[model samples]
Target: MITLSGNTIYLRALEPEDLDFIYTIENNESVWEVSNTQTPYSRFLIRQYLKNAHQDIYEAKQLRLAICQQETGETIGLIDIFDFDPKNNRAGVGLVIGSQSHRNKGIGSEALALVIQYSFQQLQLHQLYANIGSDNEISLQLFTKFGFQKIGIKKDWNRVNNVYKDELLYQLIQ
Candidate 1:
């Protein structure tokens, strides 16, 4: 995977050494709520996730990258292109800005732009889509700022905090 940099953010392939950071971030309830990942994250789980990412990359099923601060090298988030259909030239995108301190700092937007550039320029993907929970207004707005159009909403598609929530599907075509 290509390491992309801009402003104060940089993205690189998710490494095994990043498990600790991933564990800390994903374990936070605030972070997990927006992500809809209810299971408590641990170092062991992160290792497994990284292993799966490695396998997926080799098999061309998906690509995962870690978003870090350029100067400090602290892992702040993760971005991924999943459900890739090479024949159709399309993929699903996922992102999580793990650090609450980093929220609203524009880092997520920059990292997202970098990932889109990589998807279109390097992976040659023609379309990228995001499935976001209706309650995740921040992410919805974030993707919207990047030109992703709201295609439709999936009724009661997700269960969060013991309640069913709709998922809004958005897409950006290159």
Candidate 2:
């Protein structure tokens, strides 16, 4: 099983049934800045994505997992290991809790913990990285809590609404 579970949340591979949840999140204009998404994704495209979700991390060079609540079994967010480099033993991590109501509830924290362990112990990865907007205090706090240090800042990296914002690169090494 690829599922990683914690007390509050679990991370599992994307499922065909998650089309609606993933669709809504991918098309949310408000979160485009965080996700670096510039356009909406059609259901047809998303369905195609789900069909390919079974590809292993090595084969796909990326993995997207659904974050679900342990109690309710409700899928609430998504987490990813991207830019996987088996030769270098590293990958990039990104996650989004689809709803504001679910933020700050420790769900992301638990989910991140699972990923860190899975990456380091299971995957034997040397490091993981995350790029975060400088203005995102919640994400800054969340990533820092896990000992991800701010390695550098990319000035004017992302342009949102005609304003260029700085993006911070954070890294964690096992």
Candidate 3:
């Protein structure tokens, strides 16, 4: 699915124009916990990544989309379907809004709904999963709202600021 639309937002394929946006997000330390990123990335790497964004999910085993506002067409975030296993009909889903000001406004909800539809319907996937930090109430609620159940929790899974935290595995089966 090249583009998946919701009422207020849409998911579009990553484009060369998104190089700066992707670089900013990749270097944003605030989102490192959710993205499992330990260090910042340079623009050269991001540009090279964008160059390979055209690979299909089956070929690349992942799909990253830019989340754009419907009204203004300004990209606000990104969503990903990674570890795609066509033989198993399952994949991992994750998303992040670039700014705090753009969060908690139902933008993520809309973006996720569209991806879920695309994953399950167009992609013909049987299930999707997300790894969320235990302390992340917002993400927990959002996934649960879409029927993703918490299957397990890994204790001391992630270290943030030298403190270990639990990571919850949530799954949505079709």
lDDT of 3 at 88: 96
Tens digits of per-residue lDDT for model 1 on 78-170? 888888898899999988887678889999899999988988998888999999888888899999999999999999887776888899999
TM-score of each: 0.89, 0.98, 0.97
Candidate 2 lDDT over residue span 22-138, tens digit each:
999999998899899999999999999999999999999999999999899899999999999999999999999999999889988998999999999889999999999999998
List the global CA lDDT of all models.
0.84, 0.94, 0.94
TM-score of model 2 (CA atoms): 0.98
At residue 163, give the lDDT of candidate 3.
Answer: 100
Ranking of all predicted structures according to lDDT, beginning with the best and ending with the worst = 2, 3, 1
